[model samples]
Target: MARKWAGTAIVIYFLILVFMYWYLFNGDTSLPEKWVGTAADPATFLNARELMLSEQYSQIRNFMFFAYNAFDWIVYFFILLFGLSRVFERVAASQSKWRIVQAAVYLFLLSLLSYVVTFPLSYISYNLSKSYHISTQTFSSWMKDGLIDFWVNFGQMVIIVSVLYWLINKSPKKWWFHAWILSIPFFFFMMFIQPVVIDPLYNDFYPLKNKELETEILKLASQADIPAEHVYEVNMAEKTNALNAYVTGIGANSRIVLWDTTLNRLKEKEILVIMAHEMGHYVEKHIYIGIAGYLILTFAGLWLTARLMNSIITRYGKVLKITGIGNLSSLPLFLLVTAMLLFASSPLSNFVSRYQEARADQYAMEMLQDKDSAITMFQELTRSGLSQVNPPLLVKWFRYSHPTMLERIISVENYHTVEK
Candidate 1:
């Protein structure tokens, strides 16, 4: 039965891939009139060739998104069906009597297996970005970064998985609720530490080198009522050509960070506009709101996962070679359920994110009262990132966390900020 289901899954996966290829390749690539700035300067407007390149790049990326997701589902299913998870559990148990030690070993091995399985698709993505001249990192640098990513992710997963199972072992019926309770604080802790700790591991961060520009940004932040003393800049030119600026961390750790690419590529006014948008996130308290929303969703998701996991184990326990929910070997089953639920929830989560982002955009325009700079900055961002302003509905629904560049620019054009 498992083999039969696996065969059907493969066929469906390929069929879906075929449909995506056709859909992406055949989609309209014409730029909407609204996307064009009022000035209509060539410097701010992408030409036909550039537009085509952008369209193709975005479409390929969209295709890859579907492919990667479906591939992950398939991989998870196979791991469960083949009882490979149980094999890992047995090996780890043999190494240690302590359940925590066993869990750590099992998780490490599982993470390693997952990384090996997923590396090919990840490398393909990197190669595609390089071929498009988007990524500036050399092969060695990319590999180094990949290693960093793997270990960091694995370390986090180990902690999470260990806590989760311990909770389950203690109270299977109430574990999800317990986990959700613990996760609330964990979320805030990560938010606080990420800017100070995790982010600097990948790139060098320092105070903005351009004192004049930093002063201008600080003034904007002050006007927005953000208590920012200095702006931070990361040396991103070594890895990618993408332009970005954002606020990160919480409380004292909170700071505005700009990519070196942004400073090198954009005008002072444009950078200020970007800074205003970031400050909007803080002023609006979107970070706290986002966390609250996430906790709510997680509460519901964990509840559902627990219910479904129990139901599945009740029926397919013997077939999948799993003993019960608290069994060490059931980690794959738990992961599979959570992964699917998360994927299913993407459209909702992304919709909320897009709305928050749009609000921030509005705040930026209102605060700066600079529509022209806003429009031009967005255009430059689109050009730099090869973003599709009017993406297909599916991609927009599931993947986009912000309004389309077209929508953002159009909104700026029509916006009339109140007189201060």
Candidate 2:
């Protein structure tokens, strides 16, 4: 019966992929405003070649995004139905007499299998970006990064999963609540260490090489009342052609980081405007707010997951080979339920993120008071990244953390008008 369902799921997955490929690529890529440029430089508005490339790139990227997520759910579902989790559990039991050691071994084995299963799709995604001339990473470099990501993520997952099961063993009824409480600190710890420890594993970060530009950015930070002592730049040119800058971490770890691509591609004024936007995030305390919001959602999601997992186990425990809520064999079901809930709640999270981003944009304009540079910066970003100015409604809802390029440009153009 599980095989029948799995076969049906595989069929449905391919069908959805076909539909997405058709729907995304065939849709109108036209913008609302025909000309985004002044009469002086219409090419800035829409270079035909660039627009075509952007559309193709966006189409493929959007397809892969949904496909990867859908397939991830399917993979977890397959593991649950096929007794793969049970196999891992037995394997772990054979290796360790201690339950905690068994749990760790089980999780490690499961994670290894999941990584192997998912690597092909990830590789394909990387190759697609490379084919589009967006990613500059070599195969060896990309593979190294992939291994690093897998291990880092697996380590974190082991910690969370172990604590979660321990809580379940202690108080099955209130474990979700307890786990959520513990996650509050864990979340912040990850954010705090992310910049200082985890980030350097992938790319080299250094204080901005241009002291003059760094001084100007420091001045902007001071004006924003940000206690930023220095600006940092990451070496990203070897990995991608994309332009990016952002504020990350909290308290002492917090720093504004510019991708080397951004520094190399953009003018000084544009860089300042970008930095101002990042500083807006810091000034408005968006990081803490975002963390708070995430924890709140996580609290609810965990509670729901616990309820849903019990209900599913009650009905399908024998078939799934899940002995109980606390059983190591139930890990796949736990993961599946959590993944489904997260996917469903993505729009809500994305909406909050977009709102925060818009506020940051507003704050940037108000601080810098330079609409032209702001507009041009986004334009250059769009051009260099070959990003679609406007994407599909579904994509925007599910995927966009910031306003679309066109929306951003229009907002900046109308900023003064709205103020008046």
Candidate 3:
């Protein structure tokens, strides 16, 4: 049995490599379509969203898109990969159903422990800013959010496990087909509703409270040709010190959010650039592109796994708390393989993203010509957040986003240099 499993594992590993090669080559990693200032309307944003979500299945999958959420996906995917590694890290093998269930249970507890490990660091992150300390959120507040995050994620895994177990036991012959059929519609639904339905559970959002700032931002949007009638301000400063601004989901949830810290620190020139960069996302129709990207990537992975590794993973899956390829108990393994593939291709993925981010920054710079302010504010960000001023080239390409401070400075300098 051991030899049999080993043979299966070896074959599966080779197929994974071959199929991943196919994916890297086949994926349209072409530079995202450029949208000089005139990509799409900030108003017509609704149309783009509606068209994507028009089909019920597409809406479900859209909720799962996570395209605009590249960073979160990066974070979660890595953590989950680490968690999955624990399965293989263990030397003991258990094949019984109860024993396998216990393994899954232990995995869940281990994940919780990882959350606890990060708890204090998360709290300190909220308090790092000395002034106004705008946030006095206690450790308890941080803990509460942590618990919510933990349970929400675990619950998702739980549901998946239950359904997968049922499918494997009852429909083993058609498990993959059934699972894929269910996943396709479910995937689209997630894309449609996650931001609108799920995000509010975490943050409180009110329409832009200060009318002057609202008008100022609105005028900036109009100048950028973003047709947003209302701007929103979130109490992000209440939660943590890290600043963020992003164009949310496609339509209803597409409002841009300003961390109050961001609002307080940067000048209008810098802020507008941030907003314009976000609008670059909107006008470029990244949301649509993202939904399509995920579905294609997921289906491709699934297709290859079914064709090559399904029997191997399923046959010995119990040894690692995995029941079968189509079982939710085996999701960690699937996730592990997917992450490995992504990790190996991290450079390419980051390269694609850096290109998009650069384009967005250019859109903002062309609109504002605020290179000076952009540099100054970024310098402040580096100082306050302890971002390394210069990082090794490989690290910047592989791990960092927003580029190194030096990268930004040089890019701006060169733009000025070339224009002169």
lDDT of each: 0.87, 0.87, 0.55
lDDT of 3 at 193: 73
Question: Candidate 3 — which residues are off by over 4 angstroms?
Answer: 1-137, 158-188, 304-331, 416-420
Model 1, span 1-420: residue lDDT tens: 888877988999999899988877887654556544553322358888877788878998899999999898888778888888899999999999987788889988888898899999999999999988889999999999889988888888788888999999899799999999999888889989999999998999999999999999989888888888989999999999999888888889987899999999999999988888888888888888888889889999999999999999899887788998987788888888888899889999999998889899998888889988987898899889988877887888889989887678878878997787
lDDT by residue (tens digit), candidate 3, 1-420? 544644565565556445544433343322123421221211122244432222222222222222212323233333433335345324212433563464457457545654665555454444443222334566677667777888777766655555655676677566656766677667666556765676777777778776777787777778767768877777766675556687765555457778777788777777776877787766676666666766665666556555544665555444554444543435445555556555555666577666667777777677667777766666555443434344334445555546655556556645552253
Clashing pairs for model 2 are none
Which 10-residue span in candidate 3 carries the lowest summed lDDT?
35-44
Q: Give the TM-score of candidate 1.
A: 0.96
lDDT of 3 at 149: 82
lDDT of 1 at 286: 89
| Ranking 2 against 3 by TM-score, winner | 2
